[model samples]
Target chain A: MTTSVSPVRGSRDASARSGLLASRRFVSVLGWSCLVSMALLVWLGLSVAPTDAVQKDAQRLMYVHVPAAWLAYLAFGVTAACSALYLWPRTRSLHYDRLAGASAEIGVLFTALTLALGSIWGRPVWGTWWTWDARLVTTAILFFLYLGYLALRRVPDDPQVRARRSAIAALVAVVDVPIVHFSVSWWRTLHQEGTVFGEDRDAQLDATMAWILLWAVVTFTLVYLFLVLRRYDLAGIEEAADERQLERAIVERRSEAASSVVAAPEPVSVAVGAAPGSAP
Target chain B: MTDAAYVIGGWGLTAGAIGVYALLLQRRLRRAVRSLPPEERPPWA
Candidate 1:
């Protein structure tokens, strides 16, 4: 008889018995909606939006770059909030720990996108592939900080110890987000002030461009929503599986000890029961 | 690179990054569901 360890849905909650990602229909609906929104986003950004007065076609990069940056910030924000919740005595739960880990991983993905798109845009406008500008430097730091957070999560430790350490690390790393956002204004840099939120209207995008940019932001935000949901669901399942495996190992070890104490020689192959093995 | 090239590359890479990440999530979700015990497995999964 083969027993497979499936991912965790809290058996504790009867209402949630179907599991966290049980809504396949909901995911399908969301997936279709995301496809339509993305098609519209590309159309508006690539076909309808007017060429910039200065940067010309290169300005189109703004559509994707800004949204990616928005998601990076949003992802990290969720991680920090969830980490805080996990650490709080009143709201402590492994669910929040899993959520924080998932969000951080997604955040790292978007941060890399933000940086890469920024570099691609910079090459044509700034005549360079890279720059040590304050915003760029700070964003780079933000990337590595979360990367570190992800690494910390992988370290072998007791669940409580790992979660506590990761929570503190996540909170500390989030301090860099504000610094990255404000870096353009606070220091002399090649990067210009934000187009959407700039104080100078003259420096901002026109009505048509603004509308398209708004749509782009909405589309990407929806994309972020879709990705985070799936990622968080996976995290929940993975943690549940890990907990089950740990429990199994403990049981096996106890059984082995009991048999040994009785001077009963167990089959050597039976001792392999606690070893980590893949599911069939 | 031409301005048009930059635009195409920017959007392409952004889309690629997002698409790859979504695919990776789906793959992991599948594996996780498989690892679960029959009794604990989500019906939808």
Candidate 2:
């Protein structure tokens, strides 16, 4: 949650510290574009794209799985970058921490989707649901690493302390993303080598399939942008609500203390040498 | 399972997961908005 927030109504920015794309109009446009493009992508991927001569219908899984993995990387990259901003003294702000948390949460979701879709595809292509191959294992490790990052954020503590700890953890967890990507190349494994962004950077994939894959990636990126914007907005409002609650509680406690002091009887006084029944 | 089944399953799972998350986020935002004074609520809320 951002501290020192400006009213969001008719505001160009989300808050005093909002990022460049935090405008309400921009987010709304992006949401509409995401929905339309995603529909187009789905129709083309399922109906228009040519079936693989080898993998048959199972090849369709590539349209979603690759993009999902791409989103996982993109989301985590945003998290790490934002976390760095939070860690830097000059750029330090709670906005970056909330943004990082939002990105990491989306990253974890996409990672799960990637793993699940990959498993679904593997059943037909690799003839197994899962294997202990380097790529699969490394990807699993990356998933858990981010899961740990999210769990760390939930531990009750000072907001700044939590942000610092989460920022460091995000930077550390991001190291595995590259490892997962390169695992297919670094070691001999059951997983196939990357066709597009691999060591050779070959564009050897079929033309129709490649086009559809590219469209899917574009569509998913739009969807990610929309989701992140909405998530950031949600974070802002939720934090505001939390602060309001805290303030209300403080007021209630102060009033209760004041009333108790007022309600107390006056202190009785008597001369030390005087008897109980005698007057001073 | 058939190839068609897996394909459908993968796509369905993606949609379902994302749809559920978006819906839940909307619910949380609405609840939060209700808790705050009108002046403090975000435009999107």
Name the top lDDT candidate: 2
Any runs in candidate 1 off by more than 4 Å, and if so which? Answer: A1-22, A200-203, A264-280
Alpha carbon lDDT of residue B25, candidate 2? 82
DockQ of 1: 0.71
List clashing residue pairs in candidate 2: none
True-vs-predicted CA distance for residue A234, candidate 2, Å: 1.2
Weakest ten-residue segment in model 2 chain A by summed lDDT: A5-14
Residue A41 accuracy (lDDT) in model 2: 86
Q: How close to the true structure is residue A188 of candidate 2, measured as C-alpha lDDT? A: 99
On the 0 to 100 scale, the lDDT of residue A212 in model 1 is 85
Best by TM-score: 2
**Candidate 1 lDDT score relative to the true structure:** 0.82
Candidate 2: Cα lDDT at A194: 82
Alpha-carbon runs more than 4 Å astray in model 2: A1-21, A264-280
Tens-place lDDT digits, model 2, residues A152-258: 99897866788899999999999999999889889999988885555767686889889899999999888888788778777766665656666679899999999
Q: For every model shown, what is its TM-score relative to the native structure?
A: 0.87, 0.89
Model 1 chain A: which ten-residue window has the lowest total lDDT? A1-10
